[model samples]
Structure formats: C-alpha cells, structure tokens
Target chain A: MIKNKTGRIFEIIFYPLVSILIFLIIWDVGVKNSELSVVMPGPWEVVSKFIQSFAVPIGKYTMVYHILYSLMRVVPAYIVGSLAGIILGILMGWYPVINRILRPLYELIRPIPPIAWIPISIVWFGIGEGSKWFLIFLAAFVPITLNAYAGATTVDETLIKCSKMLGASDGQVFKTVVLPYSVPHIFTGLQVGLSTSWATVVAAEMIRSTEGVGWIIISSMDTNNVVQSLVGIMGIGVVGFILAIVMRKIEEVLCRWNRIET
Target chain B: MEQDRNLDIILKCENVSKKFQTKHRTKEVIGNINLEVRKNEFVVLFGPGQCGKTTMLNILSGLEKTTTGKVFLNDREVVEPGPDRGVVFQSISLYPWLTVMGNVEYGPKVRGINKKVRKEKAEYYIELVGLKGFENSYPNQISGGMKQRVGIARAYCNEPDVLFMDEPFSALDAQTRYLMQEEIMRIWEKEKRTVIFVTNNIEEALYLADRIILFTNCPTQIKKEYVIDLPRPRDYTSDDFLKLREEITENMAHTL
Candidate 1:
C-alpha cells in the first residue's frame, strides 16, 4: 500500500506533464504537415497568439482583462448562489415543511439547462450584467442545493443520537452534527457548481458580449478567423482546469479530516 | 423522602418493558425488566445473539422509550437522553470528522463547558484510555480497538453517572478484544463510574463484571444472576474463572 501510494504521488507529478507534451507534439506535427493549414493555423501560431493576447489586444481588451471581466461576472453570482443554495438546502432537508413547500419548485428548475435560461433571463433582467449573472446563478444554484440537501438528508441518525446522549439540544445538534455532516456534500456541490459556472459563462458571453473568451469564439466565426476560435477554446480549457484544481485544493484545506477514507 | 435520597442507587429500572409494533402484531423485545445499579458497579448483561440486549440497554440509557415502564437515573425519571447516561454503541460511532481529542471533548464542549476545563477533562480521559499520542488522529486513522477507546474516552469525558456500553468491543478481533478488555478494566478501576456493559461473550462478561445478569432469548427476561467475586484483572485461565464461564455457558444453553 505504501509503495502504491508513492507511485500515485509520482504519477500526480509527472503524468499530466507527459500527456500534455504528447498532445502538443501531435497537434504541432499534424497541423503543420497538412493541407489543413490553408484554412486553419498551426498549433504554434495559435499558441503564440494566445500568449501574446495577454499583453496585446485581441479586440477591445487584452486577454487578461477579458478574463478579469468573466471572473467578475462569475464570482458574484457563484458566491450569492452558493450561500443561498447551502442555507436553503440544509433548511429544506432538516425541516419537513420547508422541504414540502420548496421541493417542487426546485425540482422543476433543476433539470433545465443554464443556457435555456438565457432568453428568459435576458428578458427579465436585460442584456446587461444582470442576465449573465442570473444564468450563472442558475447554473451554480441547482447542484449546490441538491448536493447540500443530500448531505443534510443522509446525516447518520446514529451520530445524532450519540450527540443527544452526550447532552446536545436540537439547535446544538444542528450546529455540530448536521452542519459538519453536510459539509462534504456542500463541497461536492461547490465543485459541480464551479464547473457549471465556467460552462454557463461561455454561453452567457456568447449571447452578445464584447471582451471574453466566448466572445472570441463568436467574433472569430463572424470574421472567419478559425485560429482565434481555437485560441478561445484553449483559453476556456486551461481556465476550467485551473478552476477545478482550485476548488479541489480549497476542499482539501477545509475538509482535511474528511479527505481520507475511514 | 428519606428513601428517595438514596444517591448510591445510581440507576433504577422499574418494570421497564419495551415492545415494537410490526405490520400486523406487537413484537415484544424486553418483558418487564426490573433492575437497579448502585454507584461504581460494573454490571454485565450477558445474553444470546438476537436477544433484546441492545433494546434493554437503549431503554436503560433513555435512548429508546419503554412501551409500559420507567427508568430512573439518580432518582429522576429518564424520559430523554442526557449527558448523565453516556452510551458507547456496538458499532464504533465516533464522528469520523472529529479527531480523537475533538470527539473526547465533544460532550463537554456541547454542554457549554469552558474550553480550558473541557480540554483538561478530555485530556485526562484520553490518557486514561491510553490514546495519549493519538489525540490529533481521526477515527479513520486508528485501528478498531483504538476507535473503541476513543468512544470510551468520549463517553467518560461527559462525566456521566453511569455509562452504557452495548458490545463496544465485539467488532474487534480476538487478540484486540482481549487487549481492550484489559484496557477497559484498568480504566474502570481508575475512573470508578457505574457501567452497564452488554455482550454475548461469556469470557468477556466473566472477565469484567462485578455481577453478571444472564438474560433469556426473545422477549427477554433475567434468567439468572451471578456475583463475580474474583479479584481485579481476573485471570481468564484461572480455575474459578473457567468454572463460572462453564456454568454460565451451560445455564445459557439450557435457557436458550
């Protein structure tokens, strides 16, 4: 088991680097050595342009500024939605009355894709930041609430009884047992919520935006710039990967006790 | 009033009977169990598997309601579970999310005890249970015996008048079970709290109990009782120990 764990640690360090190198090599060689280069730029040109856009202008804003704008849009909605989702989900799960009233409404909204909300969101809140935030909020809220609710609902009755035996009252049980018990579920929701926020933002920015990664795709298609479109996709890919890693690290720190299996 | 002030009688069960209602009929688990425990007494409720041992323990601890009787703790009727009757369940129910110290201190911390005092209290029990270095370790990081130790420490830290243990060490392997048995005896000698331990293991019952209450099978009642006058750390291989073990096993067989 120790050896296996050491091997896993080694794989964590080197495996992603090796796979990424192979992928880059394949893309560089295949694109450069093909007639496809007439319509599509080689990997080198797209990558260089992607890097240069950080300092130079892609359109109205540099890549960094565009990323900042997307972050600004996402962070607020994600925070608000996550807080609301966690509170509402835990409450609903604990109290039967809250569950009975809210469950139907939540279930109805849960299945609809965040992109589906774009038209209605735009109409309700207008084409400003409001609509985009609404879309992102919807993307984040459903999964967070669902997972938190699951965590709350599935709290081990044994643990609760144990706490009561140790002299905790109902409110004390909720604070100590119920809240801590639901945290892992809350983290699960956070991970899913983050990824969905990234996904929905692309769709959000696609619907009439000036300076974001999704705008790169939409504007590139208009101008027949496939290289720029590829660049937008790569940007999204890298950012999404980073976001996932960040969420995982945060979960590790917050749930250090929960990370290891019993 | 004078009789009511008998503080030495720590726990009393007055015709405590429990029944379950199945889909079609009423299922009785405990049939009119009347028992009393004095201060610092180590009572073992030894019974067969599938008997009402756990139900009886739960009823006594006030974790479950009796269908038609009452239990008194320190002369007060126990309608709800309180810190005064700490229970270590059969399944190791240590909160996986809390470290050893955290779990040990949980009872005190929840009861509004100040941090300094609770920490000291928890630390003392942690040391008593021989988990001194494992304070920072989570329940998952420890062995089964160690987890059971944490459960004991957690229960003891609450400073309960009586502790109810429902097969706390039954999940352990034979070697670990023996080791934990010795550890429990050592801790109990030091702490001197009233304990009601339930198990099907005759050797364990003979090894630990001040008095053993042999229980019958389904819809259970006390079949027989024996006072274990053997000294502390009673040798399992001793003639007296084996004799009692044999007699209890024979009696249980007859009753079953």
Candidate 2:
C-alpha cells in the first residue's frame, strides 16, 4: 500500500506534465500553422510575452503587482463574507425564529446573480475598490451561507440527543456537537466560496482598477492585444487551480476524523 | 433488606405514554408504562423490532418527553436531558470530530471540569472500556464495536446516576457482539452503575438482564417481567437458561 501510494504521488507530477505538454504542443503547432495566428498569436508567442510581462510593464506595473492587487481585493472580502455567512447561516439553521424572519429576504436575494449586482454595487459604493470588494463579497457570501446552513441544520439528530443525554446544555450542544458536526459542511462552503471569489475577480476588477489580472484582460482589450488577454486568463486558471488544492489540503488536515481509514 | 428496598430505587418511570399527532390520526408509541430500577441493577427492556423500545429509553434518559407521566431520578423529576443519565445509543453516536480521549472527556469538559481532573477521569474510563492505547484515535478509524466502547466510555466518564443503552450492541457482528456483552458485563461488575439496557435480541437480554421486562408492540407497555436469578457469567446453553429462554419465547406474543 505504501509503495503504491508513493508511485501514485510520482505519477501525479508525471501525468499532469504529460497532459499539459500535449495541450501546449497542440496549441503551439495549430496556431503557428493556421490562418487564425494573424488574430490569435501562437502559444509560444503568448507564453513568451507572458514571461516578458513579468519584467516589463503591461500597463503601469509588472505582472506580479497585478496579481497582488487582485489578491488584496479578493482576500479581505472573501474572509469577511465567508465568516459572516457562516455565522448567519448557523444562526438561521439553529433558530427557527431567525430562519422564519430572514429566509424570505435571503431567498429573494440569493437567486439574483452576483454579476447582476455590479451595476447596483457601482452605484452604491462608487467605481472604487469598495465596489470591487462588494462584488467579490457577494460572490463569496451566497454559496458559503447555503452550505453552512445545510451543515448546521442537518447535524445528526442522534448526536445532539447523545450530547444532551451526556448533560450538555443548549449552548453546550451547539458548541460541542453542532459546531463540530457542521465542520465538513462549512469547509465545503469555503471551498465553493473561494472559487466563486476567484471567478469574480475579473468582474470585480473590470469595474475600474489600475492593476490586477482582470485589468490585464480588460486593458489588453483596449489595445486589442488578444495574447495579453489570454495570458491574464492563463494566470487566473493556474492560480485558481492552486487555490483549490490548498483548500482541499486544509480540509483534509482539519477533518481527518471524517475520512474513512483504509 | 427492607431499608434497602425502601431507598434503593434509583430511577422510576411513572405512567409514561407518548403519542405523536400528524395531520390525521394520533399514533401512540408508548402506552402507559411504569418501571422502577434499583441501584446498580442491570434491567433489560426486551421487545421486538420497531416496538418503541428506543422511544421508551429516550424518555427514561430524558432525551424525549413523555406525552403523559414523568420520570424521577433520586426523587427529582427529569423534564429534560441532563448529564446525570448517560446514554449509549444503538447507532454509536461518537463525535467524529473528537478523538477517543476528547469524546470521553466531553461531558466533564462541558460541565466546567478542570483539564487535569477530567483527563484523569476520562483515562480511567477509557482503560475500563479496554481502549487504553487508543486515546487519540478517531471514531471512524475504529471498528463498529470499538465505537460503541467509546460511546460507553463517554457516558461513563460523566459518573451519571444511570447508564442507558438503547440496543447498543445490535450493530455489531455476532462475534463482536458476544465479546462486547462480556466486556460490558465485566465493566458493570467492577463499577456497578444502574444500567437500563434496551434490546430486541432475546439472547442479549437474557445474558445481560438481572430482570428482563418483556414489552409489547406499538402502543407499547410491559407484558411480563422475569427476575433471572441466574448465576453471573451465564452459560447460554445451560439447561436452566435454555428452559427460561423457551418459556419467554413461548409466552411472547408476535403480532405481524
């Protein structure tokens, strides 16, 4: 079993590299040979241009500064929205009164996509970072709240009964039993919320921003630089993939007890 | 002996009945039922499947309310669940988030017990349940029977007035179930808490009960009571034991 796992870990690196190599080769050859190369540069030109953009300014700053800018907006907003959503969701799930009062308002707002809110957010917060933050915050809030509510509400009835039988009070049951039981569900929310936040970074940045991967895409559109736009998209894809891996790693660590041991 | 009889009753279920009303008819789960458990006695509530035995245990343990009547522990009414009555459920409700030590120490920790004291207390019960080396192991890492042991230890750590087991061994394999039966018996012998065990398994009831209370089906109530008077470490195949088993089985009414 140990040897097989070690072999698989090595294959993890080997398999991904092979697939990417195949994809890049296809893209590089197809674009170089095809008529579309006039409008869409070959993968080699885009990739090299992407490398150069790190040192030379794409607009006013390097590629690193753009990424940093986007991350700054996403991180704070994601954290705040996630925490608030988890708290509110748990409260609503646990308390019938709160659920009764807030559910209608939540259900009404939940369906109107976060992107649809861009116009209203821009109106309320202005075209500043506040608008960007609000958009990302909204994106993070919906999924996290839904997942947290499910987690808190669906806590095993028997476990709660067991806790009460063990002499836990109402608050004690919530803290000891409900909270722990809902953890896996909460993490599911966090994972979905994070990807949502990442997905919204472009929309948030497109509102108005001087730096960020989103700006890279939007500005490249003004200059009609399709290659730079694609590079921006590439950065987003790679970072998003890494972010998902990180989230999964954290969940595996925190919720080791939930996993079935082989 | 009379003095022992007068104050020995640790728990009493007085005229308890539970009825649930849906939109239409009212389904009665427990029909008027009464019981008394003396201190350190192992009393088994034996019944068929889905016979509201679990509901009865829940009411007795204060996990649920009786539609009518009350339960008393040391003469105090049990209106809600409290730490004084610990339950080991059939499903083995161990907190999957906590380690064996964490689960065992949970009751005391919640009740504001100091870390050192609760740890020592928890360790004792963990050892008592024969899980000494698995203090940090999570519930999922263990087998079904081991999870039940953790449940037992968690309940026992609180030092409750009575221990309620709602078909606690039903989930285990036949081999593991027998081993756990012996383990529980040994633990009870050493510690001697009032244990109210619920089970559909006649063999389990006969093996574990000091007195077996046979229960009827839905709208459930006690049908008959037998004081085992059998010697401990009971032989399942013993002539007297088999005779009593036959008597209980023959007299038992199976409806549907």
Candidate 3:
C-alpha cells in the first residue's frame, strides 16, 4: 500500500514535468525548422530574456516592478468590488422585493463586457488609476454577485425549515443558515472573478500606462521587439497561474467541511 | 380522572386534514387525524411507505398547515414552528458547516441562551446520544448513524415539550437500524420526553412504541391503534412479540 501511494505521487509529478519538457522541445524544433523563427523567438530565447529582465530594466523598471504595478491596480479594486457584490447579491437573492427592484437594471448592465466600458470609464474617471480601478471593479463585480445570488437562492429548503424548527427568526436564519450555505457558491464566484479581474488589469494597463506587463507588450510593438513582448506574456502567464493556485488553497481552507475526504 | 388525563396531554391535534392543489389536480394527502399525546408517552405512527405519515407529523409539529384543524401544545394553539417543538427528520438535516457541538447548540444560541449555558446543555445531550468525543467533528466526517445521533442531540438540547421523529432510522442499513432502535429506546427511557415516532416498520414499532397508531395510504387516516403492552427490551423472536407482530401485520395487509 505504501509502495502504491509513493508510485501514485511519483506519477503525478513526473508526468507533468515530462509533458512540459515535450512541449518545450516541440516549440524549439518547430521554430528552428520554419520561417516562424524570424518573428517568434525559440522558447529558450524567450525564457532566458524573461529571466534577464528581472535584473536588467526593460524600459524604466525591471520585470518584477511591472508585475507589482499590475497587482497594485488589481488587488484593491477586486477586494472592494467583491465585498459590495457579495452584499448586494445575497440581499437580492434572499428578499424578493429587493430582487424585483434591482434585477432589471442589473441584468441590463451584466452582459456588457468590462472592456466595452473602457471608452466611457476613461471619460468618467479619466486616463488615471481611477479608470483602471473602475474597469477591474466591473470585471470582478459581475461574476461574484451572480454566484452569491445563486448561492442564496438555492439554499436547501429543508435546511431553512430545520433552522426555523430550531427557533431561528428571519434575521438569525439569514446569518447562520443562508450565509454559510452561500459560501461555497461565493467562493466559486470569487475564483471566476479573480481570473476576470487579472485579465481586465492587463487590458486596463494598455490604456496609457508606463510600467506593467500589458505596457511591455503594447510598447514592444512600436520597437518591433518580439522578445520583450514574449517576456511580458510569460510574466502574465506565470503570475496568473500562481494567483489561481493561491485562490484554490484559500478556498480549500475556508470550505474544509464541504469536502468528503474518502 | 378525566380532567387529570386532559391536563396530562402534552400535545393534541383535532380534525386535521391536508390538501395540495397544484396546477394539474387537487390531491388529498391527509384525511382527518385526531390524537392526544400524554407526557412522556412513546407513540409510534405506523403505516406503509409514502402514506402521508410524514405530512401528518408535519401538521402536528406545525411545520405544515392543515386544511381544517387545530393543533394544541400544552393547551396553546400551534400556528407555526418554534423551538417549543423539535423534529428529527429522516434526512438527518445537520448543518454541513457546523461541528456536532455547533449543530446541537444552534437552537439555544439562536434563542439567546448564553454561550456557557448552551454549551453545557449541548455537551450533556451530546454525551447522552453517545457523541461525546466527537464534539468538533462536522456532519460529513461522521457516519450516517452518527449523524442521526447528532440530529437527536440537537432536538433534545432545545428542551421542547414534545419530540417528533419522522422515519429517523429508515435510511440506515438493517444492522444500524436495529442498533439505533436500541439507542433510541435507551435515550427515551433516560430522558422521558413525549416522543411521536413515525415509521413503516412493524418490528421497529413493536420494539419502541407504548402504542402504535396504524395509518392507511394517502388520503391517510387512522385505521387502527395497537396498545403494545410487551415488556421493556422485548425479544423479536419471543412467542408474544411474534404473535403481536403477526396480528398487526395482518391488520395492516387489509388496509392496502
């Protein structure tokens, strides 16, 4: 049994590493043999240059500074938007009158993509940090609210009945039963919202920003620096991957009871 | 003596009936049901599967509204669900997020009982139901029988005037069902709360009930009542126990 457990663990790590190795090899071979090499550098060149940019400044600041700048915009806006959305969503879901009042307006606003708001947001908040924050907020707000609302609305009827039988009033039931029940659904929304916010931050940075991963890609086009653009793409990819893993870990901790261990 | 017996009644429901009117048709679920339960009496409502026994329990416990009737608890009319009456559901609806202690203490906590008092009450009931060391375990972490034990503890912690258990052990396997039957009997004997247990199993009814009210299929009403006078911890294979079981089963077969 111990041997089988070790074998399973080994298979998990070893196969993924092998798949990555194969992917890099295929990219290298494809680049060396084709005209695509002229425009797109090999994986080795891109990776080395990406690493070197951490030490050497690409334009005004290093690669790490670019990532830090992007994070500064995404994190605060995402937090505020998520908090507001959760409150509104749960309220809308729980109270039919609130839902009836706000639902039509919310539905109208929900479908218009965050990027579509760029022109108006720039007009409303200007080409400053305010505009960028506004865009990311919209991106985070939509999914989180929808999920939290769904969570509240879909709470098991039997659970509510049980709580009432146990002597919970309306407010107490909302706090104890409705809120905890909505947590897993809210977490799902947070995951989707985080990815959307990260994606939106890049797009938001594209509008008159100096140092960010998005700025790196947009600015590289003028100089025709393919390596720099690729480095920026790698930065976004690596950071986004790390963020998703961190979010999942937080969810696992908060929702420990939801899982069946066996 | 009649006045004393009337005063002894913990719960009484009069002329209770229920009807469900959906878009398609009006279906009658429960025909008239009248019952008076004395203090600490173990009354089992026995019937065939899906025979509106659960609905009848719901009405008596104030979880559902009756089409025509009134339910009185301690001479007070029951209009809605409150902590004064507790129900142990067949589904074993323990809050998945809460620990066993949390689920047990939830009733008192919401009713504004202090933390120390509620915790003490919860702990006492938890130990009574044999879930002492598992105070911190969530519902998902426990076995099915263990979860039902938590359900019972949660109900008992509320100190309701009467406890209604709706097919509480029917979900368990045969061995666990028997074990839970014994556990329930032991708990009832110790606590001596007025209990109205609903089940379809004759052996279970025979084992636990002081009296069994047999119910007919939907448009359900009381078909018969058996006064189970068998001694405590009665044997399933004993001649008297088997004889009573056969007679009840035969009576129930006619209703179908």
Candidate 4:
C-alpha cells in the first residue's frame, strides 16, 4: 500500500513535468524553424526573462510589484462584490417579495458584460483606481449572485419541513438550515467569481495603470517586445492557478461534511 | 373502561379529509377519517404501498393541512407544526451539514434551550438510540440505518407529546429492517412516548403496534383495526404471531 501511494504521487508529479517539458521543446523547435520567430521569441528566452524580472525591474518596478498591484485591485473588489452578491442573492432566493423587487433590475444589469461597462465606468469614476475596481466588481458580482441564488432555491424540501417539525421558527430555519445548506453552493459561486474577477482585472487595469500584469502587456505592445508580453501572460497564468488552488483548499475546510466518504 | 379510554386519549382527529387541487383535476388523497390515540400507545397505520398512509401521518402531525376536519393534541387544535409533535420522515431527513449531536439537539436549540441543557438532552437520546460514539459524525458519514437512528434520536430528544414515524425503516435491507424493528421496540419500551408509525409492511405492523389501523388505497379510509395482545418481544416465527400476520395480510389485500 505504501509503495502504491508513493508510485501514484510520483506518477502525478512526473507526468505533468514531462508534459510541460515536451510542450516547451516543441514551441522552441517550432519557433526556430518558422518565419514567426522574427516576432515571437523562443520559450527559453521568455521564461528566463520572466524569472529575471522578479529581481530586475521591467519598467519602474519588478514583476513582483506588477503582480501585487493587480492583486490589490482584484482582491478588495472581489471580496466586496462576493459579500453583496451572497446577501442579495440569498434574500432573493428565499423571499418571493425580495426576488420580485430585485429580479427585474438585476436582469438588466446582468446581461451587460463587465468589459462593456469600461467607457461608462471611466466616465463615472474617472481614469482612476475607482473605475478599475468597478469593472472587477461587476465581473465577480454577476456569477456569484446567480450561484448563491441557485444554492438557496435548491435546498431540500424535506429538510425544511424537518426543521419546522423540530420546533425551529421561520427565522431559525433560514439561519440554521437554509444558510448552511447554501454554503457549498456559495463556495462554488466564489470559485467562479474569483476567476472572473481575476480575469477582469486585466481589462480593469487597461483603463489606466502604471504597475500591473495588464500594464506589462499593454506596455510591451507599444515597444513591440514579444518576450515581455509572454512574461505578463505567464504571470497571469501562475497567479490564477495559485488563486484557484487556495479557493479549493478553503472550500474543502469549510465544507468538510459535504464530502461523502465512500 | 370507556371513561378511562376517553380520559387517556392524547391525540384525536375529527372527520379528516384532504383533496389536492391542480389545474386539471381535484384529486382526493384522504377520505373522511377519524382516529383517537391514547397516551403511550404504539399505533401503526398499515396499508398498501403508495397509499395515503404518509399523507394521513402528515395531517395528524400537522405538517400539512386537511381540506376539511380538525386535529386535536391535548385539547388544542393543531394548525401548524410545533415541538409538541415530532415526525421521523421516510427519507431520514437529518440536516446533512450537521453532526449527529447537532441534529439531535436542534429541536431544543431552536426553542431557546441553553447549550448545556440541550447538549445533555441530546446526549441521552443519542445513547438511547445506540449512536453514542457517532455524536460527531455527519449524516453522510453514517450508514442508512445509523442515519435513521439519528432521525429517531432527533425526534425523541425534542420530548414531544407524540412522535409520528412515516415509514422510517422502509428504506432498509431485510436484515437491517428486522434489526431496526427490534431496536425501535426496545426504544419505545424505554421511552414509551405516544407513537403513530406508518408502514406498508404487514409483519412490521404486527410486530410493533399495540393497535394496528389498516388503511385502504388512495382516498384512504380505515378499513379494519387489529388489537394485538401478543407479549413483549413477540417471536416472528411463533404460531400466534404468524396467525395474526396472515389474518392482517389477507384483510389488507381485500382493500386493494
């Protein structure tokens, strides 16, 4: 059993490493042989440059600062948007009157993509951190609200009845049963919301930012530096992967009971 | 005897009838029926599968409303669900997010009982239902029979005036079903709360019930009543038990 577990772990690490090496080798050879090499640098050059950017500044700040600035915008907006969505969505799902009142207005806002609001957000909040935060907020808010609503509405009927039978008042039932049941669902919304907001941060920063992964790509485009553009994309990919893993770990902790051990 | 019966009656229903109205038709689920349950009596409502037995139990427990008629518990009309009446659902609806102790203590917890008091009450019932070591286990972590045990403990811990068990063991395997039957009997003997158990299983009805009320198919009404005087822990293979089972099965078959 011990040997098998070790073997499985080795297989997990070995296969992914092999796949990434193979991908990099193919890209390097392909770019060396192609006419596209003039515009696109080799994978080795892009990767080493991305690594070196951590210690050496790309423009005014290092890659670390670029990543931090992007995170600064995404984190606060995502947290606020998620909190608002969970509250509003759960209320809409639970109470018919709340749903009726908010649904029409929500539907109108939901269809407009966060990127579409870029021009108006710039007009309202100006070319500042406010406009960037607004765009990321919309991205996170939309998916989280829908998911939280789904969670609240889909609670088991028998469980609700059981709670009532157990002498729980209407409010008690909502707090104890409805809220706890919706948690797994809320986490699902959070996962989607987090990714959506992180993705939107690039567009949000496009409004006007000095140090961000988005600015690196936008600045690279002006200088026609393909290597820097690749570095920025790589930064986005690594951070997004880390964020998803962190969200999943938190969900596993909070929703331990939801996991059925077969 | 008649005066004592009237005085002992803890739950009574009068002219109970229910009809569900949809767009196309109004379907009668329960026809006119009346029942009187004496305190500490184990009354089983036995019928064919998919009959209105569960519906009857729901109406009596005040989980659902009757189209016409009234249900009285301790001389008070039961219009809505309350702590005085507990229900053990067929689905074994333990709060999935809550642990065994949490589910059991939920009744008192919601009713404003202190954490210490409710916890103590919950522990006693948990031990009573043979789930002492499983207090921390979630519903998904437990087996079906264990989940049902949690359901029973949850209802019992509430200290309701009566408990309505709607096909609680109908989902178990044959061996588990028999084991649960004996466990339920032992639990009932110790606690002796007024119980209204519903089941389509005839042998189970004979085994558990002091008084068995047989119900007909949908639009269900009382077809017959059996007063089983068998001794405690009656043997399933005993001549008396088999004889009673056969008699009841034949009588119930006629209702179809």
lDDT of every model, 2 decimals: 0.91, 0.89, 0.92, 0.92
- Two-way lDDT contest, 2 vs 3, winner: 3
Task: Compose the digit string of candidate 1's lDDT tens values, residues A1-262.
Answer: 2458778978887899999878888988887898876877777888899998898888898888878888888999999999999999999999989999999999999999999988998899999899999999989999999999999999999899999999999999999999999999999999999989987888998767998887888899899988889888888888889999999999998888887766
- Point out the higher-scoring one by DockQ: 1 or 3: 3
Model 1 chain B: lowest-lDDT 10 consecutive positions: B1-10
Backbone clash pairs for candidate 2 read A167-B83
Model 3 ranges with Cα > 4 A deviation: A1-18, B1-7
Candidate 3 pairs with clashing backbones: none
In the range B1-256, model 2's lDDT, one tens digit per residue, is 2232234888998999999999999999999998999998899998778889989988888878889999999999999899999999888988888999999999999889999999999999999999999999988888898999999999999999999998898888999999999999999988888999998888888999889999888989899999987888999999989998988877665632
Off by over 4 Å in 2: A1-8, A32-34, A260-262, B1-7, B254-256
Off by over 4 Å in 4: A1-19, A33-36, B1-7
lDDT of 4 by residue, B91-128 (tens): 99989888999899999999999999999999999999
Who is ahead in DockQ, 1 or 2? Answer: 2
True contacts kept of each: 0.86, 0.84, 0.77, 0.86
Model 2, DockQ value?
A: 0.75
B27 in model 2: Cα distance from truth in Å?
2.1
What docking class should model 2 receive?
medium
Q: Considering summed lDDT, which 10 consecutive residues are worst modelled in model 2 chain A?
A: A1-10
**Candidate 1 lDDT for residue B142:** 93
lDDT of model number 3: 0.92
Q: Pairs clashing in candidate 1?
A: none
Better of 2 and 3 by DockQ: 2
